[model samples]
Target: MRRVQVRKTHKLFIGGAFPRSESGRTLVVEGANVARASRKDLRDAVRIARQAGAGWSGATAYNRGQVLYRLAEMMEARRGALAAACRGKDEVDRAIDRVVWYAGWADKLAQVIGSANAVAGPYFNFTVPEPTGVVGIVAPAEPALLGLVSRLAPPLVGGNTVVVIASDAHPIAAVELAECVATADVPPGVVNILTGLRGELAPWLAGHMDVAGLDLAGADGDAAELERLGAENVKRIVRGKADEQSPYEIAAFLELKTVWHPVGF
Candidate 1:
């Protein structure tokens, strides 16, 4: 038997600093060293996400669209690395396409998913999609690259920042994706990704009073429980349906507001 030569190290991504997990723990995955994310890391991700704040949500739609489009371009350029990191060709292709797909939606979702209505009393009403802000996402374990991209893109395209817990057993692709995200011109703190055990961190994100929304598609066995905990804040929750694909686009992630004025003299 022969062995392949490779550099071995895994780090936690917190507040934009790539550092060793605070707990000083590491785990092995497919002959590679991976950091074991700690509670502190989880909270730090949330903090960074919140700090990015309204600037992200407040960024003009055009700027956000540009960033999303940039990400798609980066994904296309690095398609091979990401696909290899995830361990599958189809997964990589799907992940790249998914990024482009979502990028194209950033400017169009408002139009495709919105509506204009006539009010009953001489008022005009319209509804538009908006990000929920500071979302906590649980990346799925299988189909590594595409799954992670799927869970992340929609919320981000909607102008929300995300604190994601990558699949503990298969976090490599996520970290690689983070590199792409950083180069994509995506503002720092827009997507804070952590690699750790969901059972250990999902509860913290689910019940974190500060987060605006929760996406538990990857929580697997704990999806229902996380949804229950999220009820405390009435945080918007998305239960990933196994049969359905990731990166779901729905109206629930949007906020609708109506405006009224006198159109006639």
Candidate 2:
């Protein structure tokens, strides 16, 4: 007798658990059935991300760095699986390295980007960076693992919870990466991934009022429309190559808060 292989049913990662789409729909992509996320699913993700934002942002930068480093460790341990999902080992290596690189920046970004303003009066003023709240990311279509990790790492390291829309053409790697995030000691709802058509879900995410930032690095549709909708809430929009790396990427999702205090003699 031959053993039958059981195919995995990929679902949405929300609130630290995998769940089927609220609309109960699925689509075939690359010969596999993935959940077809709906507007409702997008709403659910935003709600959870909003709920998770405070605790994640309030967490000490040192602790955030530790969590990000743990994510890289988990990704390193699962490199074989990630490579398979991504269809190459080199991309997996880059994805892991990207995570590690961002991990190191988690605690150092404040010092690099923030500064104390020298006031001539008896007042002390300083600027500090804070998480910009929930961010919505549209992961790129090619080089799934690398693109997804590139978009995900910066915001997370900056202490922002996210609701990400995975690559429509290559979603298997995103689902696999979600599993990595689950075991990486990341808190619930901190990093949610929804797998479906970008055209179907990007609109809801861009227009969502609760989402503080939007990353359209992988967007395949009308850029003007998404930007216009995102403007309704004045969401911080980031458009660029998905695999691009820089400290400015992290700054895109952070808010610089300035404080002033009286300096006594």
Candidate 3:
């Protein structure tokens, strides 16, 4: 008997579950129906990220590191699927490597970027890094999987939950990476991935009051406008380049908090 091929449906990854866009729109890409998220979906994603942010950010840095390492493991297990989606194994390899690289920084971030104060007071003061809550990302179009992973990993490392708008032209890889994210045991709403036109999704995410940071490496046209929107909320904005696997990149998604304790207790 001749076998019939079943078409796969790609939907939005929100709150740790796959759901179709609230707008009921779809874009035909790579011979599949990829959900085209609307501003409503973006809002929903941000809400989920905000709810999940507290738990994820409050988790011990070591635990966050281990969770990221497991995500890298899952990505490795799904290498074939990810490679197929992106049309290249090199991209998948680098993507996995990037996840692992950021994972290693998760626990060490405090020591690396945090500092002890040298104040001339009868008190001990210290500055530490804390997650900036929900982060928004505009992933690059080229290098599909690698680009998405590059921008996504740093925020995860910093314990900041994210809602990313995937590359419009090439979204299959982002969708496939969401699979790895789901199976990696990440908390619900910790990382949400939306597939849609950046033009449609980015502005809402940038302007969202709950979203603490915005990475616009892939927001092509009108990025300046998005930056303007972000400025309104005092959102930390990254508009120039791809994410490198450095603690500094993680720091960009974090806020430094300082506290003092009386020394003569």
lDDT agreement with native, every candidate: 0.78, 0.92, 0.89
Pairs clashing in candidate 1?
none
Candidate 1, residues 64-163, lDDT tens digits: the string is 8788878878877887777768767777877777777776667777677777877777666777777777899888887788778877887888888889
TM-score-best of 1 and 3: 3
Ranking by TM-score: 2, 3, 1
Off by over 4 Å in 3: none
lDDT per residue as tens, model 3, 1-265:
9899885689999999999999999998877889999999999999999999889998998899999999999999988889998858888888898898888898888898999999998989999999988999999887888888888998888999999999988999999989899999899999999998888888899899999999998976678899999998899998635645666778888899999998994
TM-scores across all candidates? 0.90, 0.97, 0.96
Error of 1 at 75 (Å): 2.3
Ten-residue segment with the worst summed lDDT in candidate 2?
Answer: 215-224
Which scores better on lDDT, 1 or 3? 3
In candidate 2 the C-alpha lDDT for residue 195 amounts to 94
